[model samples]
Target: MATIKITTESVAALTKSAVPNKTTFYFDNELAGFGLYRTTTGTGTYFAEFRPVAGGSKKRLKLGRVGTLKANEAREAARRAIANAALGKDLAQNRSDERASLTVEELVSKYIEEYVAEHKKASTAGLYRMLLKKHVKPRLGSIKATSLTRVDVQRAHALMTREARVSANRAIKLLSAAYGWGSRHGHVQEGMNPASGIKLNEEEGRERFLTTAEMLAIGNAMIEAETIGLPVDAGTTKHAPKGQLVVMSPYATAAIRLLMLTGARLREILNLRWSEVDLERGVLRLPDSKTGKKTVFLPTAAVDIIKGLTKLGSYMIAGESAGTKHEKPRSDLKRPWAAICKRAGVNGVRIHDLRHTFASTGVGDQMGLPVIGTLLGHADPSTTQRYAHLADEAARRAVEAIGGKIAAAMNGGK
Candidate 1:
């Protein structure tokens, strides 16, 4: 029995002792209808247990620890536990019951396991995991599901936007979906999605396209640099002879030329497989495209590039290997694209813009909107209508050609 006076000094002195195992501190007084006991069970594990002296039967009430819970703090807790015990209430059991209710972190885990994996695609599941781990979990993981507010969600979204606008919008959408899932199931109360009214800022339209002169300049630069060779890692012994080195696969040069001739999307051309192309039939079959499924008929210039690519390897575009199952058919084009643009003296012309240039050029050459739409694989006609102004300019050229034909006919009759 370790006897300690009911004073604040004695409580502090008793807790600082080097007792390795369980030790109980006993108070001298009856404590005025309150009984406080400090129980130390090994290092760092300390708790204050309280029992009533004046009221009913003995009921143990745990009040935190020794280091965290001070002598004054333990006395305050003992007083409350005495009052609650006198009223026949169990304070410790009530706290345990309250904690048994679901928290936001627990609900998020459940949502991912039950909802996200089953319904959404693999990429979507990956996105949800990233948003929750990076944005939502850190700020609101400990909050109770029923207690979350709209302001909490607003702050989370705002924090994400500080880094990136697109990421912020994606986080807001994921949060909305999670809360909606919580509401549908009984984890959260009805009509209580915190992210319900949040809206993302409008995104700016893509307006970057290269001119024919700019395209020609880029091709000329690639011809001058002639740096096409396997790039060895720095400090390695695999250095190539000076002036003999050339950038890997002139595919950007080939891809740009093909896009200008066929007006196909950059991805469609970059991801093209040898199995998908029919050089004999003069058509290229694109199995997976933005418009679902489509094919492009190659012109003489585009066909010549395809024939030239077959001499390189299995892939039509002999660029960087994407580490896919088939070594030949790659999923992406590497830095040769940027190197080509650097040589061309063109600023900010992305690979995708080559496709835009192709469309604009087709509309400039008197091609019909319907004809250009088919060539571009536009899922909706409205998508192709953005290039209608260019189509109208081409129509004027066609009208002039017809006018010249009519004049020639009249002159021949005279």
Candidate 2:
């Protein structure tokens, strides 16, 4: 090692020279222990040599590559390393410890494999995986799990809210759950959930209930889609295949009917197996649902719809390849639903609103809230209370009926 003034020009001149088969070290004459090493291949690296403890062994810390870092920039880093080393701090070991720490990405993988996949429902597990992939992992994956702060979570939540508020809320909750699970299982430090207590974006409740007239229109549209095929949208058919029409599959049509009549969730109907459906007993025994092992009682109309559908392998709502070696449940009824809604002239109503419609219809017919709650498979009675206004309307009708009967009897006696 030779003591020389380390500058950009000096390092450049050394790197440009083709010094073969020998590595040379040049220490800064002005700053002790701060230097650069030029290899036999003409590449250079900046390093700082210091005694980690007073009068103890010397340790070397690599600052950066020659061209990637300026001489002044590297000197400043070396100054900090040397200053920390004088105070008995091992900067090199600190960097190595940071590199070896568990990151948020690894924690998510561990949580998914150990807890989510094992304990959560398949549908829930799938949703959690999607949210983590699309939102959580991309934003915070590289962050060290132990050092994650609530501010970091707040910033991510704020950014995610711009695209999807509901999904943002759910994603944060999922992340919080992962952290809690990690803490319990020793993967994370206790009480260190950065995602906890975030002020989530306000999401409006979607409580659309179809009127009786709308239900009749939808029923008519279903009939047309099943048989003659509903009219295609002229706007969508600009590059049409001659005289193409939108005809829903029989299985899809039945799925919609089941959704309308039984108030079952979309997945519950789509994944319904023949073994779970007992038409004779008028119930669908779902082995696993969002609520776990639920039984949906089918009314006469719902039972008739299921009875009419052909049993294609296991699933009642079969895909096109049902009964084949590649048989599986239909993924979704998005196209069929769009056609039906378009023909019915329904606007801004989701498939989930069909469930609201079923509950509203029951409430309108004077079925008590408890009865409606049981039919909808609501674990909490409060979940069924959204239709309390409709129940109030039913009560008003019953009171009017009693009053009219008493008045009529009194007049006849007169």
Candidate 3:
């Protein structure tokens, strides 16, 4: 075992290395006796090791697994264990008591309060809560945390899969996380995550992308929507006078343009603030993205789009009627996007498809996958590897072009 300052980045970096033949251990520098052991397969389990008495052998208390509990959370667990040990408390009996009569529902509540609320983003926490309440609680909530078998988990997953295949997978993921947290924190026995090693539902990738012609149509439609406006739906116009048209906000049009120009996620562009935009540096410095802090380099076209847009309040994409005392960013561009797509004669294309269109355009142009990945702010290279086939297609086209020239020369320039 090696002693070092443990951090989230350092622990994550371990996954990049080759797996060991046996379990390896690393301890925290700040908190001695608090460490994590990595199995031969690369999974790590946090633990607190200390002598139960002054002259007695040291005992190791398992805290939680890596990926489920962050390094800080593990450290906190180690601290609590040390404090309890100092008070002459029996750690083993306390752990047994903690696990006694604990149900899946109770574990879910504890996980949300102690772990999810403190560690997860608000959006992610809300999604977790929804998954637990709607799917997991309905099926497996009554089961004892220690007694939840893999078969029970499978049954719940199957039931949810019959209704929403994707959500079923996500709910199982959350349940697994809760069980893992429970085990680590002594609410359940170690290695009792029933949701583990289960196969998730096969989900088809939604990778819709626009062609050049389709992109042109969208651009023209944006212009039209901003100018003449699209016709209001009969259902919506029922509450209004006749002949009222729905005009797309300039901010909405600009937001769409940015989405196409920059291969950013919808929320990244929608929730962007003025302070985050560094026009001189040509980058958007996001403090907190889905993958933590990220800097999005702006291309010339994207920069031009931003330059042309007038800042309405603090946010680049202002909500309805800016300049109010209580201003907020636009929640979504659903209506504007739908209206523009309808006018463009494009059907079944989501706003997110614009991001795909941007990425595909780059891939089609033979930009290197690493370069494209960097522009898209993909932390993992494997994520960029999704476009590997697209890169092969580009290579095939290049070879064909070269062959065509040779054929033309062979045929006397025919």
User: Each candidate: what lDDT?
Assistant: 0.67, 0.84, 0.84
Candidate 3 per-residue C-alpha lDDT over 1-414 given as tens digits, one digit per residue, 9 for 90 to 100: 788788888888876678879999999889878998889888888888877654477778888888878888988888988777777665866788778778898898889879899988876887888888899888999888888899988988999999899999999888898887777667888777899988899999888889878889989988877887767762122344555776667888999999888899888998898999999989999988888899988889989989988877888888865668888668888877877887788888998888778778898888989988888889899998877888899989988999999999999999
Q: Which lDDT tens digits does candidate 1 get at residues 1-414?
A: 444445567656665766545555464354443333544553322223445445555665545444545656666667776677667677766755544477777777678879888976554677778877887788777888777888887887778788878877877787777777775444565346887898675677675667868978966765654454422321111345544445545565577678767878767787677788998989999887767678988998888877765335556776545334556554444465665666566888777777788888878887778888888888888988888887887888888989988988989944
Quote each prediction's TM-score.
0.57, 0.72, 0.72
**Clash totals for all models, in order?**
7, 0, 1
Q: For residues 1-414, write the lDDT of model 2, one tens digit per residue.
A: 788888988888877777758888889999898998888877788899998776768888877778867999889889999999889888888865643597987787778878889987777788988888988888898998887889999999988888899999999998898887776444665446888899998888888988878888989988988788765662222344645775667898899999988999999999888999988989999988877779999989988888888877878888877899978789887877877888889888889999998899999999999999999999899999999999999999999999888998989944
Alpha carbon deviation, residue 384, candidate 1 (Å): 1.0
Distance (Å) between predicted and true CA of 333, model 2? 1.8
lDDT value for model 3 = 0.84
Model 1 scores a C-alpha lDDT of 0.67
Which candidate, 1 or 3, has the higher lDDT? 3
